[model samples]
Target: MGSTGERAWLSAGLALLSEQGAPSVTLERLCERMGMSKGAFYHHFGSMPRFRTRLLAHFEAEHTTAIIDAVEAPGGLPARERLTRLMAEAIKNTGPELEIAVRAWAKQDPEAAAVQTRVDATRVDYLRKLCEEAGHATPDMMAKLLYLVLIGGSHVMPPLSPADKHRVYDLLLPLLG
Candidate 1:
């Protein structure tokens, strides 16, 4: 009925998407999970397509924009420090299952694919800027290298643990010089 209600539905949709992939994010499933009715869903989102659009927007905001905002909040940190903070925030805030699920969803849905492309480009662009600020010889390549590692790591079976991801970043960060 309000923004809070909409957020609850969006959050539940994300959880469902993460656990069971996009196929399971149906109106019936969501309504059943939330103990609400289809009327409630329609009341908030108007239609399933609209809800899916909002859900993807929520994912981008939470998984990308929010992390970038947090990393940039305490300004004046050195480039390397900022990069480290960005990696840390990413590891802490993002769930590998959700990332993989959305990516898989993107493969089949044009809208999801567009969002995924934007998210990947935004992330890589941010990483490239950080690399440039750190004076890396090939900032673009270095950014791709780092981002690829993250994307690759997420798809690995069992996914990389936060500690392990941190170790990987630690090894890579020294190359920024």
Candidate 2:
């Protein structure tokens, strides 16, 4: 936590936030979790509002930017595997509770909502890129369906059994080819 830079505080803040809400993401709590002083947090972020700003940015950067870049990186998995990894990472990375917490926070804060909107757009665009790269017959439609399925499947319903996810993905492969 001492050496991980600003993200250490943000990560701790997120865990608190996911467990409770934005109100729980205080410097004292984050610093306590990290075994650091409030001065450490202030060293990276001047104040609470600034730390909150960095939290949302960090969430997007880790969850969206990092994952998407890895999937599209050079000499990795094939298109299908990449797409599978995309879905896996999309739903698995931060856990649903964190996502729900962020959305809840967004209701009271414009910055959080702005970040959410940007992240959603980035994800949908990433889905479109995957479809295009895979040469899907109906790339746009597939992107939309995949996006909606992920959103509905992950939040509205319980986690899909691995076998059931495989079954759905199998049916989706033909649409790609």
lDDT by residue for model 1 (124-173), tens: 99999999999999999999989987888898887899888999999999
Q: What TM-score would candidate 2 get against the native?
A: 0.85
- Once fitted onto the true fold, the runs of candidate 2 whose alpha carbons sit more than 4 angstroms away are 1-3, 76-78, 157-167
In terms of lDDT, the best-performing candidate is 1
lDDT of each: 0.94, 0.79
TM-scores for every predicted model: 0.97, 0.85
lDDT of 2 at 22: 89
lDDT for 150 (candidate 1): 83
